[model samples]
Target: MTQDNLWQLDAHDIARQTTSGDLRAQDSVGAAIDRMNAVNPDLNAVVVDLSDEAMARAQALDASRDAGTPCGPLHGVPVTIKINVDQKGQATSNGVVALKELIAPDDAPIVRNLQNAGAVVIGRTNTPEFSFRADTDNPLFGRTHNPWGRHISPGGSSGGAGSAVMAGIGALAHGNDIGGSLRFPAAANGAVTVKPGLGRVPAWNPSQSAERGLLAQSMSVQGLITRSARDLHHAMPTMIAPDPRDPFHVPMPWQGRALDGPIKVAFTKNTFGYDLHPEVEAALDTARDALVDAGYKVEDIEPPNVFDCGRDGYRALMGEVYSLMKTDVDAHGSQAIQDIFAVYFQEFPPFLETDLLQIMAKRSHYARQWSLFLEDYPLILTPFLPRPFFKPDRDTEGGEGVHEVLGCAVYSYAMNFLGLPAASVPSRLAHLPQGIQPINIQVVARRWREDMAVDACIAIEDRVGRMCRPLWEHMASS
Candidate 1:
């Protein structure tokens, strides 16, 4: 492989080459750093560059290989760590200005797992303030622009991870999702990601002062965003490795038992009264057709009450935020974020006190319904958003903006609430008058079946083709 284009190689390919002595780990890391230097200026995707340390680490890995040490699956692949998570000497800022000076004393589980598996951390990515908004911008890191163009938002909290990985700064980008953070950025940047089910990937920040709410712990999950679906197969296994810090982490292997013959998939286009954009509907049809072609039995059947579940779940989450983080947000957050949260409360009124507890308890009822529905159909194909991704700061337009961006996105966050694995992949690249952008579809798998969801994403990707080629072509031309 040419050194100049080494940054474009996926984690699987990079590992194979580096492990077989066909490529040098130092060269691979250097190429990625060069790519970050070349493109990251305009994008602002990577806020903290770790090139010096990454190069030193890559050299050490090469020396270890020369000394006959057994290589990990990730070998010498470069990956980015989201700033929200601790990484030993780095700051766990989570895009908040007040926390910018708060340094971490140890590595978060996700960081340790990735580095342990031989993936070098090249840099730290940005996020929205408090990591709450759908768009990526903060008082600390400013805004991360979409690689497609500035016309689109770099979908939030994991926005920088999505942008950096897709822009060739890293082969894999570590990102966590509480709501739609992982899939939102994947949809925005045309990347592939599987939001791991509850306890699939262990998570904890050593620098934090207190424990999070029960709902926060249950809904939040650590995951990765990659440029190709096949990359997930190579990287996610190591990511799910158990950590002692998170006692709740499941010890199950990444690959589960293969289902008998063709898997049945439940398909739905129900937008919950929101107007389903033609492009989004086309994207769903493309995914359905792709699954059918891949020998999966696709049927048009709605899986439980997604609208009710999504609404109640987010409202419940808002209540948790209100009780737990509201004061901090009010005190430390910028006016823009404060305004966004104000709109969030208006859109999904929080249930307080006893009502909050009752709604939290009702989570099982929704999960149970989806669990039964998945028993009949192991996979569900649905629209990630009712339309193509919105423009930057569209969320700042007020109530209608929040409704358009989040309210219409019932399918994306519903999986997060249910604590089920969901994968997002591009099924169509819509050529709008403004510019070409990818349209993504969501695939929800049964609990602890993230492997299944990724498999379905690969099947769809096989038909629709990967998004990186056109994206790179655009980047080169521009």
Candidate 2:
């Protein structure tokens, strides 16, 4: 293999080579830094470059390796952290300009876990204002462009992470999702990611002044975006390492109990009354075929009421957001974000006060229904979005636009509401009239079965192939 583009290697290969003493930690970090410098000017994916610190850390890791110390699973791997998360001394701005000077005094749990596993933070990626929009742009860091071209929106609020990883700026990009942050970007950028189930991955930001709302705490999750599904498997194990900061975190092992026989998957092309794009339908079929070929017992069935679960769940979340975050957003957010939220309220209509209390109680109802459904099908294959990714600032176009961009994303956020693990992987690359882009399909696993979801992602990936090659080719030609 060519060593000229070491930055393109996945986290698995980087760890294998670095731990085996075949590749120097400094070399990997340097390659990633070089790549970031090359593409980030145009992409703006990495808002805060940490090349100096990353290089120093890489040298120290190399010295430790030379001195015969054992390496961590992610030893020498370069990664990016989302700007919304605390990373000690860096600003957890969450894309709000007014909070730009608010530096974190300590690292978030995900940051500690990544560093403990020897992952070097090359840079911090961008997010939308208050990290709420479906498209990544902020008055603080501007817009993060899709590496594929300007035709696509680099899905937010983890848009920067998705754009950076796929652009080869990092092997893995750390991002958190409340609704569809992780999956949105993965789908937009043609990357792979699994949004960990509630309690599966520890999460806590040391810079926070107060506790998040009950639903916010339950729905949000931290995860990584990568170029391949296998990379998620390699990195997520270390990411789930225990952190005492998050009291609700479940200290469960990454690998769960094996099933007795072929895993059954519930497949559906239901778009919840939205117009399901032909490309998305084809992508779902591709995933079904891939799963079937991989020995999964694929059945054409829909899991519970995803539409009701998604709608009520997001409405409930809007209530929590209105209660807990409305002030910060009103005070610090941009007009663009505020207007988008207006449309969001019109679309989902936040349930307030007592209604919020009742909806929060209803969460268990949705989760329980899905849990029973999973008793027969351990996995569910669905479309991440009813259509391909929308253009930049699409959500700002009012109700119809937000509806097209986010309203149709029932599968993306329903998992967050239910706190179930869902993996997003590209099943087909669509060549549209404007340009070529990848269409991602989602595989949601039973609660705490993130490993199974990732395994399913890998199986589909084995058939459809990784998306990075085509993306890189497009970049080169462009």
Candidate 3:
């Protein structure tokens, strides 16, 4: 296969070729690195390049193949890690310049898990500072622009992973979601992302100690971003292997079972209190129609309280968890921490003692409500965001106010807070400046129900087909 073709093949296809001896692992890794060099300068998706190490690992895989040694499922596939995850020698910057030099001494559990499953970590992708906002931009690595349009954002905090996948730099990239980080960017840039239920894929930072509060433990989950839904199907099982590092890591059986009859989908065009832009609404309508035509029962309903959970409880919990990083920031470097906090304090006032208690109380109540809601509705079909795509902004300004992009977080952040498995699936191309016209719907199920989520994605893929990526030629100069 041509080098360009190697870059475009999904992880499963690459693995099949390598396992069958049709393609050598080293050749595939070299081609992937070359493609990264060819396109990264224009897109800036990958912030750290591990070309040498990746090539070495690829060569080892080839030698093993020749020696007739059995290989793991994802053998020799090139992938990227979002910089927020620990990958040994590299720092998990999380877009904070002050912590850029804070090197990780060991591979994050998920990184090691991927490596054990035979995936190569070719590089680290960019993220927003502390992943606080929806758009991926920070002083450390600047911004991850959409491959569809340089003038727009790729979505954060996994924006880099999303952009890199769209540019055909990697078949898969590791990403974690605390808010909409994984899903929105996947939606923004025409890719697919799964925020597996908490502990479905163990997440830990060996460089730092454990989190301290309810929100701290509740709001975060780790998973992958990829061009094809099948990549996630392959990754979810491998990544969820038992890891003692994350206490929350569950050994629940992956639902590798058959889909339970025709799937039931609940579609909500607008968030509870928000308006969906015409393009986004139309894209969602198209997806609903497609699902209906595919013989799945699609019902339009008020997506249960996801918006209120995010606005009222999720944000409060996230603020508390993020504040825990203050010590890490202070010990390593404090200037950036102070600057970001200054902005944060200005925007959202410190909660009164009573207000803080109220937020915490509401969290427990909200979690129960969401649990009951998911019992009847096995799947949800909702827009990832009200807007089709957002343009690049130097800061959250313009007459739209902080709430414009901030408000859209409800569609994604709520699932993270609830510890439910959710996915961002692009429905189709629409009239968006990003060229990759995309609509993302969050597919949710009970905790540890990732198998159901994947099945829904496969169902959607069988119906709509995966998003058509930009040709390498079109994105080469992007």
Candidate 4:
């Protein structure tokens, strides 16, 4: 591929060619940097550019290749790291001005893993204050616009990762998900990602002075966002590499044992009490049709109670936040974010004291039920959001806005609480009044079977096609 279009290729192809000496690492990284410079001004997706160091690393990689040094699996593939995670010398800013000087002394596990696999870091991406909002904006880095248009938000926490990857800034963008962080962005930007089960990918921030609460430790996960679902298959193995710093990390290989017979998938249109938009229903149908055509035995059946599971889990998480984080948030968070958190507390009232403990214990009960249900059906297909994604700063409109933005996301956070792997993939690209946007559906897999979820995402993608080509054309025309 020519330099102008090199940024369009996925990480797998880039890795294959670079590993075979058919492509130079410098060319790959330079193309990404050039693309970032061209498109990132409007998007604000990348907050910290590391072009100089990236090019230097590329030169060193090329020299090693010339000297016959062994290549890693992701040789020369350009990637972006989320600013909340550590990267040796870069700031783990988490989109807050207070943490802008919090330089990391060492690489976080995911960062070191990507380096070990020969991926080049092109830049660090943006996030909301404290990385808690469902849309990307911060006092430190400003707002990250969706590549599609200003009408829709670039879904947050990992909003930058989604927007950048889909906009062709990098083949892969690193992100983390606590609630619906990864999936939300993937849905908003028409990208693809699988939120790994608990302990699947080792994670820690070297700049942090205190440990996270129990629920935070249990629910949050590290993952990657990419234009094509298969890119996750190529890159996620390295992300799961064991690190001594994370004692709870599961030391497991990427692929799990093949299930016998046709894989069964439990499908549902249950939005609980929320009104399911026609566009969302259409997207779910498309995904279900694609899966059935791909030889999956898709069935109409409800799995576990995701609504209650998600509600209680989030309330319990809020309880922990209330106890441990309110003071810091009140002290350092922007007034906008502070106001959003106030509404958040109103929306999901924190389960206090013994109630928190009880709900935390009940998490295992939900996980067990899901585990048993997964025994019958290896995958569950559901709506990632009950409607199309909302506009930027919708969460700032108070309780009604927060409900619209996050309340309907039962299928998302429930997976995190249950510690089950889930993949988000676009099934439809719709041109709406605001702008053209994608509608994505979630595929929840059995625990530790992130591979299966991504496999289904690949299948759905094979039928519906990826959003990158259309998104690129749209950006060009705009």
Candidate 5:
């Protein structure tokens, strides 16, 4: 293969070569770093890279292979971490300037597992301030632009991970989803991200005590961002290995069997009270046709009020989180942190304590209603956003602009509120340049059916290919 081809190959392909001694781990690691050095400056996807550590690990893995030691599932492959997650000795800035000096003393559970599986950590990607917004940028890390069009957003919290994967810096990236952070970026940037069912991958933070303890119980999970669905299936078992520190984690094996019938697929081009851009709806149509061509039963279906999940519920969940974060920022008393506080409180002034209590009371109602609805349908395909990738610097605006965020995010947040698994896969390109359409599908199986969600994604991949390679590869030489 050509030198350029080395960097663009997927993680599974790279691992297979390393396992068979056709490619040394160091060569793969070196090519990945070279790709990072070439494209990261423009994308700003990775902010805290561990080049030396990566090379050392790559060398060690190659030595072990030479010595006849067994290789791990993802042995010698490269990956990046979302900056919001902890990595020992690396700062979990989450794109906050106030926390730049705060370094983590230990790795988050997901990071530890990825390392244990023999993956090389190339660097850490950017996130919104505390992962609060849906675009990746802050005073600390600046903005992560889309590899397709430098002026467009890759999508947030996991935006950096999405950008890096599209730019060929790594084969896979570790991403967390709460309010569609992982899938939004994946869809916007024309990659793929899986929001595993809650507790599928253990989660914890040694950096600080948990914020709003209920957030620990609901609406968040970690999984992989990749260019292909098969990669997710390959990595799932290693990712969810039981970690005793995370009590919420269930010990489920990665293995799963596909149902023994033509899969009944349900699709919603838009969501409750949300308007999808015309191009996005067209992309869904294209995706539906692909499934029909694959001999599956495809039907247009409207999901019940499940999309209203966490309206009041999120008020209780996120309102409590906002208050806790306010307390921390106020403790620092820094002008920057204070400024963030002002924007937050101004955006959510009516969040009184009594209102929060009422919202919490409604959580079970929404969760139960959503659970009941999913029993009839196995999959719900929808638009990843009301629109495709929007212009960069657009999301930083709050207030009225926040409405735009909500409208675009209709399909994403509800899954978090219900703690169901969802995956975003690239469907086709929109009319705009580098503007690819991503099929935002929620696989709402019973609790612990993350396997079903991922399996559906693999089926989608078999029918329609993943996103086209980002233009950055060609532009990198410029």
Candidate 6:
């Protein structure tokens, strides 16, 4: 492997070499910093650069290793944290201008976990205001352009994380998903990510003044977006470490007990009445074929009533946001975000009072249905979106655009409502008239079986191949 291209290496390789003393932490951090400087000005993926701090940490890690401290699993690996998460002394801006000065007094659990595992934080990535959109652009951070091309929207909330990882700024990018934040960027950028199930990873921001809404707490999760699935596998175990801050977090082993036979994958192409774009359908086919080839028992099966689960779930979340967070949003949010939320309320129609509690209770019914179905098939292969990713600002066009970008994403959000681990991995690369884009498929595993979802993503990736090589070629030529 070329030494200069160390920034392009995956977390698994970087950690393996660094742990064996064949690579220095400083070298990995330096290469990542170089990559960030070269590409980030164009993409704006990393809004807060921490190159100097990263190098210092790398040097310290190297000295510790020299002094005979045991190497952690992620030793010397470069990673990026989303700005929404707390990093002590750094503002947990969440892409809001008003919060730009609200520096966190302590690191979030995810940050501490990554540092404890020896992963170097290269920089903080961007997000939409309040980290609440399907696309990334904020008054504070401007926008995150897709590394693939200017025409595409880097999927939001986690868009910066997705873009940074794919652009070789880092091997791993920390991101959170509360209804497709992780999956959206992974799909749009041809990156891979697993939205860990409820409580799979500890999540608590030290800068947060109040606890999140009930649905928000249940639906949202901390995870990573990576160029390849192996990087997720290499880093996620460390992310799941027990933290007293998150009392609800479930302490469990990364790998579950093996099944007795070939893993059954229930596959579906049902787009829930939305027109399934040919590219997306083709991507689902590719995933199905890949899994079958990889020895998974693939069967055609439609996901059970995801439309209802998604619709009611989002409405309930909107209610909570309206009840608890709306004041802050209205007070501090930009006009654009405020308008977007207004439209969101119109489309999703927030449930209120007793209705909110009723919907919250109904969430369990939907989860139970999926749980029973998952028992028959350990995994469900489905479409992440009904169509190819839309252009930037697609959601800003009002109801139609939001419908196009989000309404068709039932598969993506229903998993969140059900609190099941769902992995998104690119299966097809299309040379569209606008630009080259990647289409991703969804793999949902049983509750608390994020490893299973990631395992399936790896199998699909091994067959279809990683997206980074082609993406790099495009970047060099463009």
Clashes of each: 0, 0, 0, 0, 0, 0
> In model 6, where is the ten-residue run with the lowest total lDDT?
405-414
Better of 5 and 6 by lDDT: 6
Question: Tens digits of per-residue lDDT for model 6 on 372-418?
Answer: 99999989998888888999999999999888888788887888889
lDDT of 1 by residue, 196-224 (tens): 99999999999999998988999999999
TM-score of each: 0.99, 0.99, 0.91, 0.99, 0.92, 0.99
Runs with alpha carbons beyond 4 Å of true place in candidate 4: none
lDDT of model number 1: 0.93
Q: Kindly indicate the candidate among 2 and 5 with the higher lDDT.
A: 2
lDDT of 1 at 48: 99
* Higher-ranked by TM-score: 1 or 5: 1
- Stretches of candidate 1 above 4 Å error? none
Q: Which predicted model would earn the best lDDT? A: 4
Candidate 2 colliding pairs, count: 0
- Alpha carbon lDDT at 236, candidate 3: 73
State the number of backbone clashes in model 6: 0
Please, what are the lDDT tens digits per residue for candidate 3 over residues 1-478? 5766788888999889999999888877888898899889878999999999999999999998899999888889899998888889899888887778879999988898889988898999998777766678778878777877764678877889998987878788888787778886888787887888876777778887555466656677878888888888776788888889788788877764555677677777766667667877776777777777877787877756777776665557635744665565555433544455444444444443577678877777876876776666677777777776676653356325445665556767777767788888877667555455566776777666777777677767777777744435456554
Segments of candidate 2 deviating more than 4 angstroms: none
Supply candidate 2's per-residue lDDT for 428: 95
Candidate 5 vs. true structure, TM-score? 0.92
lDDT of 5 by residue, 53-157 (tens): 999999999999999999988898999998878899998877777788779999989999999888999899988777766677777878788777765677887
Q: Candidate 4's error at 129, in angstroms?
A: 0.4
